[model samples]
Target: MKEKLFRWVVKHRKPIIAFYAVAALVCLFLRQFVGVNYDITSYLPDEAASTVALNTMGDEFEGDIPNCRVMVPNVSIAQALKYKDKIKKVDGVEEVLWLDDAADIDQPLATQDKDTVETYYKKNNALFTVTVNSEKEIEATDAIRDIVGDEGAITGSAMSNALATTSTEQQISIITVAVIAIIFVILVITTTSWAEPILVLLGLGVSVFINWGTNLIFGEISFVTNSAGSILQVAIALDFSVFLLHRFNEERGRHGSVAEDMVQSCCLSSVAVFSSGCTVCIGFIALAAMQFKIGPDLGLALAKGIAISLVSVFTFVPSMFVQFDGFVQKSQHRPFVPPLGKFARLVLKVCIPAAVVILAVVYPARVASTSSDITYYYGTSHIFGSDTRLGQDMDKVKEVFGNSDTYVVLVPRGEVSEEQALSNELKALPEVKSIQSYVDVASPYIPTGMAEKDTLDLVEGEHHSRLVLTVTAPYEGPSTFKLVKKIRCIADKHYPGKAMLAGEGVSTTDLKDTITVDKGKVDLIAVVAVFAVLLLATKSLSLPIILVLVIETSIWINFAAPLYTGMHEFFLAYLIVSSIQLGVAVDYGILIADRYREDRVTMHKREALLETMEACTIPVLTSGSVLLISGFLIHAISSHGVLKQIGWFLGVGVSISLVAVLFALPGFLYVLDGLIGKTTLKAHFLPKDAQDPVSDTTEASAADGSAQ
Candidate 1:
């Protein structure tokens, strides 16, 4: 069956070549219409618990959705009141609520005692809350910026959207350009012909379009699906093309006819490429097992994309290959010689003593270092910009609001009827900065002698119930946690089954809590899925374990570097670490193992290892170098530190995986060969050659005549 398929490809090469040329042109034009989505909310599952809760809250809030807080500095109560109408007149602004308006008019500042008046109304500074009705229709970021204009600064969770989107787009663009450039350079170096790289790129472009067109046919394309998988496709397709072309050249060098050599090349290279693609597809499919919404989507998209790339390699790549085979053969390119191969040989020569030294020194150093901080995921500029925004906003909020901290407590609807008890308990909490409830708002102007409980009559109505307590902490760190916990305890004691906490701080805490709870399950799923793919691909129990070890080591080393660099962040670590490890490590493992298996058939275990190293090293190193250049280029373009961190970690991880494959895999293979029976190991490494039960001299004569 394989021989027949090979013969067909050879016989119809010209027609196939023409078909591919037409297809490539069609695909090229179709790709321009594809759009990319950058919304973070897109990553969330439609039915996820947090998403559900958020949606429920949104529905309840109705027309009163919360807007991002805005702060202005060096402004007084009078000044704020004076500009209140001006602020309200802003195009997007609905209404501005300030402390001056919130305060009771009956107890005017001049009537209150000095200390009481001072506490109630500061002379110079005032805080205001702006409510925009279009919160749901318009992005909070766009609305906030429109209102604030150039007059004042705004900061909060809303700002994160703009910053994150801009940074992510920039990172993607920079990485894509850099990766392409690096791949082009590497191709030129290896093939020694500028035209070959251009041809490979042309093939890649066609593959990308086909991949897109297929996805479009399926339905709406996912942004993550498109961006993340496109690069992976390009990398895999280019490598496959290089492999096929190289094999074609080798067959020709053996004095075989062009048609025969082309058939042989396709048969040999396609098997390896298809096998590798299957493994990658399995690895990605395994991600579907993850509980997170984005995880499954990422897995499915990547798996599909890889499968498409393999098909493209067989069809589109072959067609292009047939057209360009003559030029490629004439190029006389030198194979890549990895710089690290020589270093590996040097280490092997002094293995015993060097191993002892590494164990003694490096092992201890590894213990002292820890996994990288999540902040490092953002890279440098992102962190600095975020910090600047936080600091500037905090300073302004402090000046205007008299306190930078705020908290919101939710009392159950039933518990709100017992508002007096809840308010008293909430106000008594040690961390309470200030307390406000419907009770404060309902009471008419009261004299100074009025009892405190009587002042709470404002919220006594049955339909309108509940108190909101705002707390200010002495310090930013542990105090916020302590305050929140104390308030929760108070709510539990007074409202027992009903009250809960919900606000900016509470929401942030909830997100963190959810991640912590789900982290282990997600991690386990990812690890198992990746390992299973590796196991099936190598068809060896030990190789899968070694691959996992190499991946883990790369991740650890990549993450730890961020800690030393002091750019680590929790969000960055959670998002990028596993993704980077999964993306680059699997590719490296497949390429190395494929080469090893191909070499094992013709040589002894030791010689096979050496030859595999020589054959695979160039592609592996070139791929790694391209990945690194792309990552660094992203880091350079991104002002966001998290992106820089991702770039750095991903680049480093790829480089380390490359090194591990070259050195660690060979060493481990050597040990495995020593332990496993030589015959089994050799058989495992050998490629599956086509079986020829029948020979036809007539066909051979025709093939030779056609070649001439």
Candidate 2:
């Protein structure tokens, strides 16, 4: 069956090439339909406090939690009121609150309360808490910016999301070009034929483009998925092509014709290709199980991209290689890379010592990794540097307003007396800077009957009354999370199960809780799935255990590094890197072990180990270098917080994984060859008849404590 398929593929090489060409055009055209969602808060589970509160607010009230705040500095009361009205009139601006709503702006400035007045208008600046529809954020913010030109500064959750989406999308375009250029240079230095690199890129690039087009099925993906998915596809796609090229070139002279060699290569490469790809897919597929929607969003996209790249490599790559045979053949140069035989010997000599050192430190690394300081907030304020406009605007607001956020507490409208009592209790709390409700404002200043219809409507909904609490806490952190819990406790005490809270603090708490559950679940799922794949491929019960152990050690150290450095990693990055590094980086170990297994059939242990290292070293180093550089490059180039953390983790992870696979795995294999030989199916760990000759140097080294 395999022979027939390969024969047909080569026979119809031109037609196969033409099919991908047309598919590429169709995929490119389909790219416009894939939408991007930027709001991380929207990914919260339905049962979370913020999500429930948000839903109830949507049904019961015309307004939502404030998402944007625009400050027009140096404006008179009348001018500020005029500016507020203009902003309110803008399309998509649902509700705008200025000083007039809280304290009568018409009153004399001397008689009006100073703290109340200064909350909205202070230091000749008027700050407006604008509730804008998330879908219309860009349109509304742009129009509001037009209203308050040079003197206005805008920052809030809405504006932060808009900036995050726009900037990340832009950075992806720039980084894709840089990544491609660097990958091409790496391939050139490693590959004997220059055209092979071009073919590999074209083959893989088309797959990534098609992966984007395929996202139309998802309707919309998170901006995080769209930002990171394509680059990862490009990087991982090379793994499949690298193994195929190696198999093809290695089998070139033994076969009668190029087509025969290509077919033989495909057959020989199948186990490695599927094993590696399956492990990577398992890693991504585990993410789809996360309670956080971004997990599914990113997981499905990345898993799909990996599957598509695998198919493209096996089918499209073979066709391209055959069709462009003369071009690829003539472009061949001497491979600039060489097998470091001396280095392999040295690594083998210290294998036992290095393994001992790794074992001694790995436990400490695992403990520290679990204790890493993780931040859950996705706000661009924390992500972007203070020099950025978003960060500056946030700092400016905190400096003036004393670092506060507004949470809308919803409860059944019982009576003005009860509501007022609830409001007063809430206002008395140290965290509660102020409170705004119909009971708080209407009774003291304007009678309910005399209040303007719009102002009254903002506070009173059909089934619920809204108390907007101004709390002295930043957007998200331990303090804000604690504040949210305390406020929820108070609201529940007054109106249990009837009251709901909506704000960034509540949302961040939900995000933190949701991801905390997924971290363990994802780890378990990935390990089990990848272990099954490794077990089936190697047909050895013990091989999978050893490989997972070595790779997992690398992961422990990767996450633990953040603790030593005092960098509070984004919480999602740990789960992401753990799965990615375990599944993806384990391929290096797989290659080494598989080669060692094959070579042991004909040669003694040390001879086979040397040959395996020499054959496996170039591809592993090339692919590992590509992945590591791309990781650090993304970390360096991307301004997005999540991407930066993910990039840094990936860079560090791949480097550690490389060291383990190259140095540590060989040691384990040498020491445990008897176990592997006894356990692996068909038993290829030793030469036939159990007596293979070793070189004098290798024999002398073995006598010095190589075998137990």
Candidate 3:
């Protein structure tokens, strides 16, 4: 079946190339329909208390989240009120809540509680909560900016997401170009042919487009997925093409023509590439099982991308190679990277001691990785610096508000007495800076009927009453999470089974809990799935265990370095890097181990090991370096701290994996060869011979000639 398929592909090479070109165009056209969602809160599970509260509040009170906040410094209540009225007239504005919205501005200021009044109207500044549909936030924010002019500040989730989306959209083309250029240069240096690098990129570049275009099927993807997915697809696509090219070149010496060599190489290369691709897909597929919607959003996209790249490599890349046969051969040169025989020998000598040191320190690294800072998840760090309007607005609000945390508490309405009691208890808490509620604005002493209907409706909904609790603590500290719990306790005491908390503090707490549960599941699924693939491919229990250990050690070392430096990593990044590194980097071990097994059938253990390293190291290094550089370049170029952190860790992880695959795996295999040969099903290895060098040197020289 494999021979027939390869023969058919070779016979229809031109048509196959044309077919992919058309498919790529169709995918490109579909790209416009791929929507992007920037809201992190949307990633939360629907059953979460915060999510329930938000939906209920939206339905019952028509009080959508005040995702955009406007801060006007040194402005009087009268002027701020006028400004609010003007903002309300904007096209997308739904509701504008200010001090006057809660109480009649016509009434005397002396009648209101000082803290309640100051919450919105301080001595020299006023804050307005402008509620707009998330879809129209950019329009509404632009209109608000025009109204507020240079003095006022605008900062919130709505604006930050809008800014991030806009910034990423503007920079993606440049980043993609930069990545392609970098990979092209690396391929040129490592590969023997200049034309091979271009063909390699062309083949992979089309695959990236197909992956992106197919996102139309998903409707919308998370902001992070769209940002990172393209680069990853490009890198992986290039790796697959490189694998095919290397195999094709090896077959050239024995075959009569380029077309014949490619046809013969297709089946073997497809098996290897497909197996490795499955491991990568498994790694990402585990993410789709996460309760967090972002996991599925990113996981499905990446997994699909890898699948598409694999198909394109098998079908599209081979066609291109045959079409450009003459140019590829004419452009051949000595590979810039030389053999690593001496380095491999030195690394093998220290393998046992290095493995011991790694075992000793891995636990500390695991423990340290668990200590992550959740604060960065809530705030926005602008990529364009503070000189931009978004950055300046963020700074202005932070300066006026200091570091404060706010919570939106929803409780059953119509229990005026219990509600008043809950409000009083919240006010008395040392952590609570202030509280804005119906009881605070319109006292219980005043009959509900006598109060203005509009004013009453603002705080008291049909089924739920809203209390905006301002706390002195910042969003990330222990004090802030503690304060959130304290407020929940008070709500349960006063209105048990009816109260729910929804805000940054509540959302962050949910994220921490949700991710904690999902992390274990993802890890287990990835390990089991990849293990099964390796077991099936190699038919050896011992081989899978040894390979997994080598790759996992690299992951431990990658995360451990951050802990050693006392750097605070984003919690989600730690989980993501762990599974991805294990799945993707394990391929290097598979490549070497597979070759070693093949060579061992004819040669002794030491000779086979040396020959395998000589053949596999450059290809592994080329692919690994591409992956590493792509990540670090993102770190160096992107301004967002979240993206930068993710890039830095991925780059570091891939680099560590390369070291383990090249140095540590060979050492382990050498020492464990006897056990492996005995346990591995259908294993065959030649007897040890003192004259193994003759065959090794001859094979190495022939391999060198072919590369040049």
Candidate 4:
């Protein structure tokens, strides 16, 4: 069936080319409508306490959980109130809370509770919490910034997400251009023909654009998905075209026409490319199964991309090569990087030692990889690395007022005395900066006519009264999560099942809980799925073990680096890298193993490995190196901490994969060749004599029958 499809591709080269051309153009046009989601909170499950509380609050009340905080220096009570009013009037500002809202600012502020007053006003600086709609984050933040001018700093979800959106868009644009040029240059530097680089990139590029264009169907993707997916698709799937094209060139001398050569080339290279693509897809399938929605968000994008790239390689690549045969022939040049068949001699000397070393470190590397310091939260300050306005503002806010986090508790409106008891207990905690509840700030149990409007409006609600706790939780971490847990306990202790908690602290804590579970599950699923695919692809039990070990060891080595360096890895990057690196890096092992399986039909295990290295090294390393260079390039240019770490880890990850695949994999295959052959069915190469270059014979069948 696949052979027939390859023939169809060859016969209808022009139509295939035309379809891709038109599809690429159409997808590009549609790609613009695909939205990018910057809110990490949106990825949280609906059942999370924060999610439920948030949903309930949105439905029941006009007020929202504060999304931003603005601090202005050298402001008096009246001036601060004026600033509050101005911020409140901003188009997107639904609510802005300052000291005036809770206290009678018309009187001397010193008469009010010290902690309560100081939480909002300290060192002649006034801080205000601004609630803005998620959709208008950027516009609203911009308006808020304008109102504050140069003397103020704003930090919170609104501004953080705004920066996340804008910065990711800009960074992605720059990264795509830079990485493409880098890949092209590397391809040209290594390939035997100048046009080979162009054709390869063009095939991969069109697939990438088409993948992005197709994102319209999903409506939106996370910022990380769009940021990482496009480039990764190119890097991971690059070898498909290279392997097919090289095979095409090899077959060209025998065939009468370019179409015939391409058809045969597709036949020979199909299983290799398909196997590699399948393993990569398996990795993504595991990621898509993650409890965290962002896993599926990115997983589906990447999986779809690899699928599209596989199709492009089999169809568009063959068609374009045939169409541009004359140009390829015209531009053909001597290879700058000679075939690395000689490197097999060097690898033979070290393969044992390398494998031994890797085996010895396997347990430690695995342990270290799991033990590396990781952060679950990505605040704007952290993502921006304290290098931009958003980051700097966040730092300034933290410096001036310390890490003030707010938690909103909603309870039955009539339970004012219980709320007061809860508020008093919360106030007794040293870290609690202030508490604004109806019992403290308003005349509890009074008729509507007796209560002050501003104070009553701030805490009172029609169905559920709001209690705002300003605490020194320091944004998000183990300590903040601990505080959140303690606070939830306190709320429940006082109000029983009725008290609900919602805020950044709660959300971040929930994120921590959800991802902690997801991380291990994602890894397990990816390994098992990829291992299953390998077992089927190679048809050898031992070979699957060897290939998966090489791939996973390289990943372990990559992830374990941060532990040695004392660099805190982002938890998201950890999950993303685990899935992506496993999915993509396993290709190296599969490519080598697949080619080895093919070559062993007529050759001994040692000779098969040498030949395998000779044939597979360039494409394998070319693919891995492309990813390495791209990862490092992104690391260098990306300002986001997680993105930078991802790039670095992936770059280092591929570097490890290159060495392991090129050197250690040969060792493993040679050492375990007997087990491979014994566990396998009598192997027969696919394709006719035209596709099978080894020239089959009774000797070939005898050699194939042995454990390779």
Which portions of model 4 miss their true places by more than 4 Å? 372-381, 448-457, 684-708
Residue range 617-693, candidate 3, lDDT tens digits: 77787888888888888777665556667789889998888877887788777888888888778887766654455
Candidate 1 matches the true fold with a TM-score of 0.76
Greater TM-score among 1 and 3 belongs to: 3
Best by lDDT: 2
lDDT of 1 by residue, 1-708 (tens): 776776776677678767766776776677667554433333444544335434544444322223345654456556666656666666555545555433544566666443323333454544445555432323544655555555566544345445555555666776677778888878787665556787778777776766666564434444445544666567645656777665665576453567676677788776556655665566566556544444566567666767766776666666666667677668656655334456546434543443243234344334433442323121111243534554466555555444433454545443434666767666666556455565454432343235354334322223333344445542223455566567767777876755556444444444444445455555566667667766655666666675666666655565555456675454533444455456456666666666666666555555556656666666666666766666666556655554555456556667766666666656656556533333233344432253221123446778999999
Model 3 has an lDDT value of 0.78
| Runs with alpha carbons beyond 4 Å of true place in candidate 1 | 1-53, 63-67, 82-96, 105-127, 131-151, 207-263, 269-272, 278-292, 327-415, 430-437, 443-501, 562-566, 572-575, 676-708
- Give stretches of model 2 more than 4 Å off: 109-114, 146-151, 372-381, 444-451, 687-708
lDDT of 4 at 270: 84
lDDT of each: 0.55, 0.83, 0.78, 0.82
RMSD of 1: 8.0
lDDT of 4 at 23: 92
Residue pairs whose backbone atoms clash in candidate 3: none
Residue 145 error, candidate 2, Å: 3.8
Candidate 1 whole-model C-alpha lDDT, 0 to 1:
0.55
Runs of candidate 3 with Cα error greater than 4 angstroms are: 102-114, 339-353, 371-395, 443-451, 689-708
Better by lDDT, candidate 4 or 3: 4
